[model samples]
Target: MITITEKEFKQLSEYIKINYGIHLKIEKMALVTGRLHNVLIQAGFKNFTDYYNYVVSDKTGEAVTTLMDKITTNHTFFMREANHFYYFKDNVLPYLTSTVKDKDLRIWCAASSTGEEPYTLAMILDEYFGMNKIWWDTKVLATDISEKVLEIAKNAVYSNERIASLPAHWRAKYFNKINNENSVLIDKIRNEVIYRKFNLMEEVFPFRKTFHTIFCRNVMIYFDNETKIRLVNKLYDHMEYGGYLFIGHSESLNRETTRFKYVMPSVYQKI
Candidate 1:
């Protein structure tokens, strides 16, 4: 493993926090070593300080994006948290039907990686409500910082092991295999999600309308406390009043300034 000195870690932390509002914890050395060692080796750097210096000097954002992509955790799968989807289908969907005219429903999968989360959101919404076939508007905005992952997300292919996280019925209905190595999303579900690259550290969101819900699960654990607060506030702005925010099960918003009332553990409603 490539050992990063304490000083180098702090420098990298400050740089990432300043540029991306992401906090690299001390324990994430494994992540740093696993993901970024190649960047160092390719650059012929013997230590992380050299890599850090190279990154700092490159103002074009490619290196920065690469760094964030490496340091951030992106492990996720379809239906990773079943209850959140259940709550959305049973509770949130009904609310949207009454409140939205033209049957419009928009959801933002803010940390969307490799498409599973947003695609899963689409499947759950369409399966129960049959919205995929409807003429009225309904779509998922899926965004991630990594262009590499976003490309895979745009393709919407997965392995059986990846789709194994999905419900049996959804797995049967929404996915089809091309070969032993991969599966593809059904056209119905794939057409409903829009993928793009987004950086949470940016001051403005590209969305033109507030979303009914935002699934930002498991993404914020990479950020510092202050960064978390700022991100929650920004997400609150993009959410319709009374819309929902579903975070990772392990993450909490106890100190956040966003006016979201706790709906349950790891779930909050914009107020």
Candidate 2:
């Protein structure tokens, strides 16, 4: 395994955050070293600095996106937090439907690594709202800084092992087994989600339409307090009044919970 010097690690971390809004935790040093060393070897670079220069200066600029996808920690599965989904279905949806006069529901899955989280949200929505119901009435916008994961998300295919945690009924309803080894998200459910590339640290969020809910879970644990506050505020800005924001169970609001009153554990509503 290759070792990343402190200097190299700092350089890589800062570059990633500047380009992707992802703060690499110090513990991720091993992860970065393990994942990036092969690419360095493939590029015939002797050290981290050489590889960094090549990545940043590449004409096509695809290397940076590729790097983001590789290094971004994407440890997620369907229904990872069963309670949040339960709350969303039982409490949140009914409330949003009754209060929001538009009758259209929009959700943003910020930092939606790979596709599980956003697609899972789509599955929940489809289960509640008819799959073929008014197309314009419900939509999910899923964005990640990594174009590579976005590609996987668009494919909407997963191994059965990856989906073992999902409810059997949901697995049966939303996914089709392929070749007895893999499963693919049904087109109807997949079509309801829109995937794009977005960086959270951007000065101005470009969303014109507000969301009924936003899922940005498991992402802030890597950020510093200042970055976390900025991200939380930005997410709040794009949410409608009474909108829901779901963070990871292990993460805390770190003094910024004032903007969003805690509704349940790991769940907040933008007040």
Best by TM-score: 2
Worst 10 residues of 2 by lDDT: 129-138
Candidate 2 off by > 4 Å? 1-3, 25-27, 255-257
* Per-residue lDDT of model 1, residues 113-207, tens digit only: 88888988888777767634475577899988888788888888899888887778877888898888788999988999998888888998878
TM-score of each: 0.91, 0.92
* Cα deviation of 141, candidate 1, in Å: 0.2
Among all candidates shown, the one with the greatest lDDT: 2
> C-alpha displacement of 67 in model 2, angstroms?
1.8
For 1-271, candidate 2 gives per-residue lDDT tens digits of 5578889899989998876667787788888999988988887888888888888898896888778767877777778877888899899988887887767888888877779988887887878877445643777899988887889999999999999898898888889999778999999889989999888888988888888899888888878778888888888888999999999899878544468888877899987
User: Which clashing pairs does model 2 show?
Assistant: none
Q: What is the C-alpha lDDT of each candidate?
A: 0.83, 0.84
Model 1 vs truth, CA RMSD: 2.2
